[model samples]
Target: MQITGVWLPIITPFKDNKLDYQSYKRLIDHYTEKGISGFIPLGTTGECPVLSDYEFEEMIEKTMEYNKNRLPVYIGVGGNCTSQVIKKIKIAEYYEIKGILSVCPYYNRPNQEGIYQHFKSIAEETPLNIIMYNIPYRTGVNMENETIYRLSEINNIAGLKDCSGNIKQTAELLMNPPKDFSILTGEDLLFFLTLTMGGQGGILSSAHLKTEQFVEVYNKIKENDLEAALKLWKPLYDFIPLLFKEPNPAPVKYCLEKLSLIDSDEVRLPLTEISDQLKDKINSIILK
Candidate 1:
């Protein structure tokens, strides 16, 4: 499948500590028609680490059910344990998802060779396409472009969620990308930059808001209307950082609640609600 355009690492809606299927369905319905390229459930933005195994599977099931094949779905199936990640991939395969966004091993800080082996093992286990997620800040070990290029040789290692946080590396990869291997940014702020530099698109968390505007920016850029794309991107440029200022999903959930897209903005423990100050600031932005 082509991994392009704005893919939302969708937020899981919770109500009194339970999966809010009603709201989750609403979100799927809401975004499917918003020109979003696809959906990614059970990602970091979905609070993957905190979800129970049952909830994890349930989320995948609900996503497919609600989405109804209206758009592509890429389930986030990742863990530090290569074996465990493979197991999750098996679960995802049971569904009709387009692919899996597997993140790099975290905390273990695996070396490049180890990183390479981790993905290699996964590729061997499945026929499904894999979009390797490389967010060094979270994983604690960067998957260098060399390792990525090497992996691209493996036919099923289809793409990457490029959050390496190194523009030079990103630029180099974009300049000489492997044939049929996509490089979609995971960083929301870098959406336009990635497009300008020849990236496929982004798996953006900030896309949960301003969905059409985000799509328009990608469309404009692809159309080579840089001036028009910049016009759309400039207004969103400053506000993107605030959604992440307090941690993810919290601020995003708050905004969704304000818009009545979801019933509540409650996040699990270890990820509390946004600060009152940030809430007020976001509220003002929404009002404007």
Candidate 2:
């Protein structure tokens, strides 16, 4: 629907290398109390790639059960295979997800036209609203503004998770965005800057720790208090890098565990747990 405000690309917590649905539900309860606007289960923070199909479905099922439509839930449905991605989207539709955050295909490095065709097909295939996720670093192919604008023309292709990391591009898009197109930043570190550039909000992992403070930043900016928003975002200058020091959800999951929101800070393979040194650094700051 209208996807705006701070959404958590929540980590899929693991215990003994198994999906901890109990802990997962508990984490949602915690963030719900924190007043998070929505949840993005199975996103990068959710360790989507490593999860098996069964785990993926079970996770979404659990998330939906707990969420109970309390807040919007955007399922992460992305893959290099257009058919497979659409398959995943259809599966999510079974749960009646509020929306889908489909990433630009990774590894294949599709040409701009290929990117357009891929998302265009998805929009055609589903009645569900889609938020195109453009993280060129991960996908290896940038969805240029023109391509994104073209996709935006499709009625069901709702908005974007702009992780292009190019200020000029983000600013230009914001300057004259499509009607009802929500431009939410996927970059945690750029949340403040993105808002200043007229972004809707962010799908942030750093938000796992200081949830209310992040919300406060958005509220301050919406109230047109840049000074107050900047004050709230200042501390994140140091904290954001640390959350990403190791790799995504690893650092974030570690923080959540420290706060007793999750059972463990464990992550799946290809992504190790956070380093001891970085853990100490995080503990030193948060524990203080």
- List runs of model 1 lying over 4 Å from the truth: none
Which candidate has the top score in lDDT? 1
For model 2, the superposed segments whose C-alpha errors exceed 4 Å read none
Q: Where is the poorest 10-residue window by lDDT in model 2?
A: 279-288
lDDT of 1 at 113: 98
RMSD of each: 0.8, 1.1
Candidate 2 structure quality by residue, lDDT tens digits, 224-275: 9999899888997778888887888888887888888888988888998888
Local distance difference test, each candidate? 0.94, 0.89
Clashing pairs in 2: none
TM-score result, candidate 1: 0.99
